[model samples]
Target chain A: MKKHNYSAGPCILPQEVFEEASKSILNFNESGLSILEISHRSKDFVAVMEEARALVLELLNLEGKGYQALFLQGGASLEFLMVPYNLMKTNGKAAYLDTGTWASGAIKEAKAFGETVIVASSKDANYNYIPKDYSIPTDADYFHCTSNNTIFGTQMKSFPNTTIPVVCDMSSDIFSRSLDFSKFDLIYAGAQKNMGPAGTTLVVVKEEILGKTGRAIPNILNYEQHIAKESMYNTPAVFAVYTSLLTLKWLKKLGGISAIEKINEAKANLLYTEIDRNPLFKGTVLKEDRSAMNATFLLENQDHQELFDSMWKKAGISGINGHRSVGGYRASMYNALPLDSVQVLVDVMKELEKNS
Target chain B: MKKHNYSAGPCILPQEVFEEASKSILNFNESGLSILEISHRSKDFVAVMEEARALVLELLNLEGKGYQALFLQGGASLEFLMVPYNLMKTNGKAAYLDTGTWASGAIKEAKAFGETVIVASSKDANYNYIPKDYSIPTDADYFHCTSNNTIFGTQMKSFPNTTIPVVCDMSSDIFSRSLDFSKFDLIYAGAQKNMGPAGTTLVVVKEEILGKTGRAIPNILNYEQHIAKESMYNTPAVFAVYTSLLTLKWLKKLGGISAIEKINEAKANLLYTEIDRNPLFKGTVLKEDRSAMNATFLLENQDHQELFDSMWKKAGISGINGHRSVGGYRASMYNALPLDSVQVLVDVMKELEKNS
Candidate 1:
């Protein structure tokens, strides 16, 4: 049976990327050394680091724009602490929009370094919608936000047009769609979601926003130091970064973010349409803010749970079970997910409706 | 030419470990999923994590002991700061032995969290010898030491029998020797050297030594939080940890540390004997404190440098050029290095002497 992977990250990456990564692990560029064994400073791997950084910028359309991209160890969870540690100015408050658990986590870490103000939040409604019509605090150090809620299935259609520096955690939906790259002062993502594997974090920062905090940042956590050394100050997540580069190349070959966004929307539309019209299920998040990345839904009748689960399992679906926060099912249709797989799920939904 | 890898980390791993790791990256345990794509929480990877943590305890002879093992990101460099953040009590002092670059980096980070006292140092002698007969301060929160200096080729032959908690940075020499497992309160090692690759740090902490610091540790850096969560506090370095498990399994099959130590010592001795007898070279560290992991040496005359370098390159030696701190050559004889490779190097040294 062909398995449909929806295991929200360390999720689906291109089959070719996996092949190339596997081959490199055996022998990297004919160097007679496994990518796992070679030093990051070796020219072969230095090329990999440089290419991975360049591809991150190229895919984002931020190339040659003074935006530096780095691949560092510690997942996006650590970036929650580092973003505030490096940018939250002394005695100044950073404005945050708490949309979901990840956003709330970001806010918690930011509060440890300086004052954090919740300018807006959708947590009150179980984070089913992205809050709007909130005023920006002009005196805030920066405005931090999560672009997508993976659990509750909400994504920001438009970002705040604030005057302060804009920091975003785009972990789950970074390369799945097109974005206005210049608008963000800093962006971070755990690689397991949309990028590569779980070891490294992808950090893209506009250089000028740093150094205003006046606090001495730890060398390993300091973005400026990492950029100065080109992300090799400390030993990096070499295999993870190399695999990410391969994924980026595959994305580029598939015509970059704009091309993939169309496919992603079609997949999300397929699943959501089935959920709405099938009568057996309903979408979880607000209709307008429904995530094009993770299509979350639930069976309308609780008694149908065992049947639905058994049917999905027999059909070879993986990771369709919903998170504890919102129980039922979540089909994460990331970039590597083909629309055909979504069609399979749509077919599964139709079958479920027919049997009922 | 067949390459002889002696690069100081992201260094040599067992050949069989590399092959097994490569196979798993393609299809982990016949799951038809790349190890890179599966969720860390999946039973397969959870088993990997549990086995990895258990293997660390087993290799260190700590099974059934109270020490909790964790695999984390940001390498040993991250552990430098985490050690003090989690253990250095409020307004308390931590004592550090200044051995080499990594130890100095550890002290630099520890100073940020609490007062750091350098109880002993070897900087006056260019770090050629491990400082001896220094007292560990009893009033200090903990005493920190680097068990092996990768750059200087000096190792601590014996640890201080101190009453306070003892912390060790064993990045370069772990799994290559036998140590008294019950001696230390905390031990952290970056995985690139003898264990595995570059992204993860292996942390083994005595459970009772934590929660005394009173400082709020970030979720990613907190020791107690990681142990409580069984080291899946976040998406760990999945590939690195998986690879490390394979290496540990290989170590166990080779009869664990005691057997590897003999092979390591023989490799070190083979190269050091040539350095001592050959007219062109001389060993760097003191005889008593000489490292079995990294053997640093110097050419007696700079005029023969080009010929010697070309000869070694022709012999397919990689990364023999010593670090700038200690000029001439270094052959890092890790657990994975076969004695035959060291014999090849020794033969080259003899050839150079004959030519001279």
Candidate 2:
């Protein structure tokens, strides 16, 4: 059975990227050395890091700025703790937008460091809508927002325009859209979503935002330590970074973020439109706040949820089950997910509707 | 032209492992979904984690203890902070043996959280050998040591046997040999060197040692949190962990750690013998203290370093260059390095000796 992956993360990656990465894992660049064994500092692997960093900046259209790109270990979860540890100064407060599960996690980690003000929250509505009109405190060190909520399928389409440096946890939506680089002081994403695989976290931080946090940060958790040492403060996740670089190269060949955004938007629309039009199903997240990365919906007849799930699983649809916390269906439309895959999902939904 | 991969890490892996891992990356388990796209919470992945954890215990021959195995994100670098966060609460002090770079890192992080005592240090000898004769703090929380110095190529053959809990950062040499697990209260290794890849860190800790640390630790960094959640406290580095699971399974099939130890010993002897026999090169670390994982050496003729490097490079040998701080050569003989590869390196040295 041919299966189409719709998991929110550790999600689909480009075929070319996988092929290239697989070859290198066994014998990197025909060096008769496994990619896993190569030193992160070796000229070959250094080129891998350099190219990976460059591609990220190139993808973001922020190549020359003082922004330092790092391919560090620990997923976005570590970043949750690291963000505040590096930026939260003595008795400093960081504002966070509690959009979904990941946002809550970020908030939890920050609270351990210092006071964190929840600028906005969508939990009241079961995270079906994005809240607006939250006041950003001028005194807050920085504002943190999750660019896209993987579980809730809500995205911050427009970033809050504030003088306070904006930090984003774009674990899912990065590289699926275009953004003005000037707005974000720091941006980080776990590679499982739209990039390559798990194991590497991409951190893009403005060089100037660091050194303000007076707290003596642990070197491993300290972002400035990584920046100053160029992410080689220790041996990095070499294979993951190398695979990510290949993915980034693939994205560039596809005309960077702009071309992918069009594909992503089209895929999301195809799934969302079917959900809205189909009487048997209803979109979970508000129509205005529907995500371009993850389209979530619930079957009208809850009893048929299992049937729908079983039918889809039979149709080779994997990871369509909504997060257990949010019981429904979620079709993650990351960059590598082709429109045809989404169409297959839509076709499954329509056939079920027709049979019913 | 073939290349030999001698890069320290993200280093060499078995060809079979890469082949199997690559197949799954593109179409996992014939699901037609990329392994990267699967949810860690999914039954398939949960099985991977469970099996991987079980294999670790099985390989270590540590069974029927109140111990927990975790596949954690963040390298041992993160654990440098986490070790103290979870274990340093009793307030007397934790003893650490300062071996080399990573040991120093752990020491630096431990100092920030609580009182840390350096019981022994090899820095007096420029980290060329492991220290001997150290007073294990009688009332200390735990004793810590780096098992092998990847940069310096030294291994501690015997640990300081004490009543107080013993913690070790076995980042470089984990499966390289067999050991009595009862001696150490805690052991952790970053996966890059021996098991698989660089994204995941393996932690084995006795459950009782946790929660004694009075300091409130970040949930993700907390050992208790990972234990309670079975290393699923957060979204883990899924693919890396999965690959690690594959490697563990492969290790078990190859007769576990015991079989690999003999092979490691043999390979290390071959290279070290070459370094000892040849007048052109000399092993850097002391004879008895040399590491089975990383073998460090210095060229007698420094001027011919580049010539030797180019020759090695042409022989498909990669990552043979030593650390900039050390300025010589280091051929890391990690667990995955085949004896044949070592023989090839030895042959090249012999040819070089004859020609020189």
Candidate 3:
């Protein structure tokens, strides 16, 4: 049976990426060595690292724009701490937009460094909408925000114009849409979403924004050190980076973010249209702030839950169960999810309405 | 031709592990979903995380010893910074044994926390041997050392008896040998060595030793947070951990460390004996401190370099090139490296002498 995987980040990557990654595990690049067994410093793996870094910049259209792309480990959670360590000064504060769980998590880590100012938050409304009209403190070292809130199904359609270096955690929506990526000084994403698997985090940082923190930073957390080492400061996640490169190559072959954005929009629209039109369900977040990558919806009547669940399961649709915070379904339409899968989900929703 | 991979940390794993891991990437556990595309929170993956953690303690004989095993990212290098962050108090000092490159790296990170006392160092001899006669400071918060030095090809024969907590970076030789295991309060190994792949790190620490540091530690760097979350404080390297679990299962089927220890010792002895008997070759590190996992050797006569290099390449041997620190050959025989592979290398060395 064909499975439509929509379980948020670490969700779905291209089928071809999975096939090549699987084959590489047995014999990487025809080197007669399992990808898992080869050294990270090996010429073959080094090319993988270099190509992955270069491809990330190329896909984001940030090539030759003073940005260095690094595939580091520990996911975006580590980036939360590293951002403050490498960017925030000895006594300087950081302004953050508390959009959702991840944004607030970043703010929590930044508070450990120095003063952290929350410019705006939609938590009072349970993070169902993107909070606009936020004022960035000019004196702050940097402004931080989450590009997409996976759990709440909210996304920042437009970023705030700020002079201070902007750091965006694009963990869930990166590579899913087209944007002027150079506006952010640092853009980070845990590669589980639209990028690749779950082991590596992609960090794209402008060279000029680093080394001004004025505090002694640990070499592991310092962005400049990683750049100098060419992301081989220590042994990187070789297999994860290689798999990411495969996924990035797939994305590039599919014509980059601009091309995927159109397909993603179609998938999201197909699902959201059914949610708005069908009498059985309604969208979760405010329509304007709804995430194209993840569409959250709820049953108009709770009695239809069992019928809806079984119908999707019978239709070979998996991972639409909503997060604990929101008691509904979330259909994550990442770059790899086909429009046909979303249509199958729409049909399931219609069947549920008829049964109810 | 079958290749004998000795790439040193991210070296060889069981061939069966590679086959199974490769299959899982396409469809995990008959679930019809690529392991790469599944959520880390899924029941199947959660089981993987649980099994991998349990298997680490089980294989190490650390079960019921109040030791918590965590699969983390950023390799042992990140653990260098984290060890200091989570262990060393605000005003506390740490005692370290500077054995080789990785040990010195750990000591360097410890210096950022507070006073780092170097009890002993073999730097004068280019780390050719482990400095054994050293007194760990009684007042120090903890004692740190590297169990095996992959670069210099040396291993600590025995650990120092210390009342203070002991921390060891067993990255290159964790599962290849049998140890008291409880002697060290914390043991961290990057999974690329004898375990699985190069994405996740295995951190086994005694539960009692945590929360002693008085400094405000970031939650991301906090061991307590990871333990509380069952090593899923963030999105874990899902595929890496699952593959590691597969490797650990293979080790268990091979009768665990004590059984593999005999095989590892035999493989090491087979190659070391040939190195000793052959007139063309000489071992790099001191005889008494030579590592069983990684054997660093040099040509007694420089003229044999071309002949030996060509001979090994023709025999389907790879990754024997030594690190720049040691200018020669390094045959890393991790647990998964069969005795037959070492015998093939030994035959090549004998052939070189015959040709010479």
Off by over 4 Å in 2: B1-4, B90-92, B301-316, B351-356
Q: In candidate 1, which residue pairs get closer than 3 Å at backbone N, Cα or C atoms, i.e. clash?
A: none
Residue B112 Cα positional deviation in candidate 3, in Å, after optimal superposition: 0.9
The TM-score obtained for chain B by all candidates, in the order given, is 0.99, 0.97, 0.99
Model 1 segments more than 4 A misplaced: none
Q: Which one is best on DockQ?
A: 3
Error of 3 at B124 (Å): 0.4
How many pairs of residues collide in each model? 0, 19, 1
lDDT of 3: 0.93
lDDT of each: 0.89, 0.84, 0.93
Q: What 10-residue stretch in candidate 1 chain A is worst by lDDT?
A: A17-26
- Candidate 1, B304-350: lDDT as tens digits: 99999999888888888888999888888888878888888898889
Docking class of 1: medium
DockQ, candidate 1, comes to 0.76
Q: Which of candidates 1 and 3 is the stronger one according to TM-score?
A: 3
- Residue-level lDDT tens digits of model 2 in A1-356: 65687877778788788778767766678666667666677778788888888888888988788898998877898899889988998899999999999999999999987889998898998888888889999999999999899898888878788999899999888888988976899999988888778878999999899989888988888888887787888778777788888889899999999999899888887888899889999988888888998888899998777668778888777777788777788888889888888999999899889878
Candidate 3 ranges with C-alpha deviation above 4 Å: none
